[model samples]
Target: MIDIDLHMHSTCSDGLLEPEDLVNAAGRAGLGVIALCDHDSIAGVARAMAAGRARGVEVLTGVELSVAWQNWRDVHLLGYGIDLASPELLRCLATFAERRANRNREIVAAVNRRLDHEGRQPLDPDDVTALAGGVMGRPHIARALMARAYVASMEEAFDRYLVPCDVPKTYWPMEEAIAAIRRAGGAAVLAHPTSISTDFTVLERLVGGLAAIGLDGVEVYNSMASEAEAAFLQGLTRRHRLVTTAGSDFHGIDPGDTMGKGRGGIRFSGALLPPLYARIAERQEPL
Candidate 1:
């Protein structure tokens, strides 16, 4: 009854812990296998893998790609077992990173305008960037706001400034993202499909359409999915012939969110890994 968590984050993205500390935490949490699925960056993977080796935790190379599908502008695709050196994958991630940086600048500008209206000092984009270990994210900006005493907490930063001042995120087209994962020799699994839509009918159609376009698996057991929703997703994967996986989506910022187990005891059995591994291997096979 080994436990595995297929999704988590580190300072490489917006997560609170650094890559090495994240792995150490996972090792302490008793997660046998874990994936450091940083948002749009794999810069921390090597460090995390090294820490994993030392901690006796099996770290899988993973990334959470932000992608757009249809009218849904913020869907995430998790790529597992990816080739860190894949040119196509690297190119796309680099492009997204630049876009994210630009967006952060825009967000700062907007935040500055609000601050000006309120007669407060403006946030410096450089300061926000300095807070991020890897790719700049909203969480970094929120920390900047906190440091400036503009917001009391991360939530207030988002609700008052970060969310309101957000520039639209540029996203890879869903098809292109899935193709990039395949090119990188990885399995592209939709992370927390329930976030796209909790309505079963719409969610089913979305999953079906993605499956038709090369989605390798669906994350059925996710922290975001309710028990009933997870059950439905399990059946949905069977209906679409897609492999199923689970993740805690841990970022280590929120309270009560465990590593191997999510909030409310959402746990994944190691049994989920075999099919996912098989799918990743199938993608890696010469075509």
Candidate 2:
């Protein structure tokens, strides 16, 4: 019974826990294998790997890259078994981090303007980043708003103010994300497809385009998906002959209190399944 959590974040991204803390928490939770799929950065992977080694847990070097398509659909591509030390990948990630910081600033300013119109004190980026404990994002802004009793929850914050359509920032395009993952010799898995948009036809088109662009997998069993949705995604994976993957998408310190630990206990079982450890090991093997 190998417990695997393929999608998790650390403070290297927006997650509450540091890399080492995340690994230790996974070990405490009885996870046999874990992937530190931090958003747009592998900066935490090495630290997680070290922690995993100490805890007897296998850590997979992974990342979750944000991809935007022409249809205004935001796609998240999860890369597994990537070379964390790749200079090219690191450089690209640095650019992405800079862009993300800029986007966060824009969102902060927008949220502040909205709050100020309501005669409320606005949150500064510094305060939001302090609350985030690292690079800030909409989630941090939402949390700050919640703390001030402005928004009831993260979902409300997004729905009212920070939705992509209303925000001034855009995600990196899909083709660019796919190419970066491919160049790193990593397998790209679509992360939590249902949460992005509700249109199944649009999702189908996105999956088709991603497959054509060399996408290796889809996260058919995500913590957020209902049982029926999970089954549907599994069917879609089969239909497309795509590698089906599962993940908890654990972001420590839940803001919405919607997504739970271990991705609602949806763990991958069986030796035949493509486990994160196996992928990392295969990548480590000499060619």
The TM-score that candidate 2 achieves is: 0.81
lDDT minimum window of 10 residues, candidate 1: 255-264
Collision pairs in model 1: none
Give all candidates' CA lDDT scores.
0.90, 0.76
lDDT of 1: 0.90
Give the per-residue lDDT digits (tens) of candidate 2, residues 30-91. Answer: 77887889887787899999999999988878999887877755678899888877778889
Worst 10 residues of 2 by lDDT: 255-264
TM-score of 1: 0.97
* Count of clashes, each model: 0, 1
Clashes of 2: 1
Q: Model 2 clash pairs?
A: 248-263
lDDT of 1 by residue, 158-211 (tens): 999988888888888999999999989999999999888889999989999999
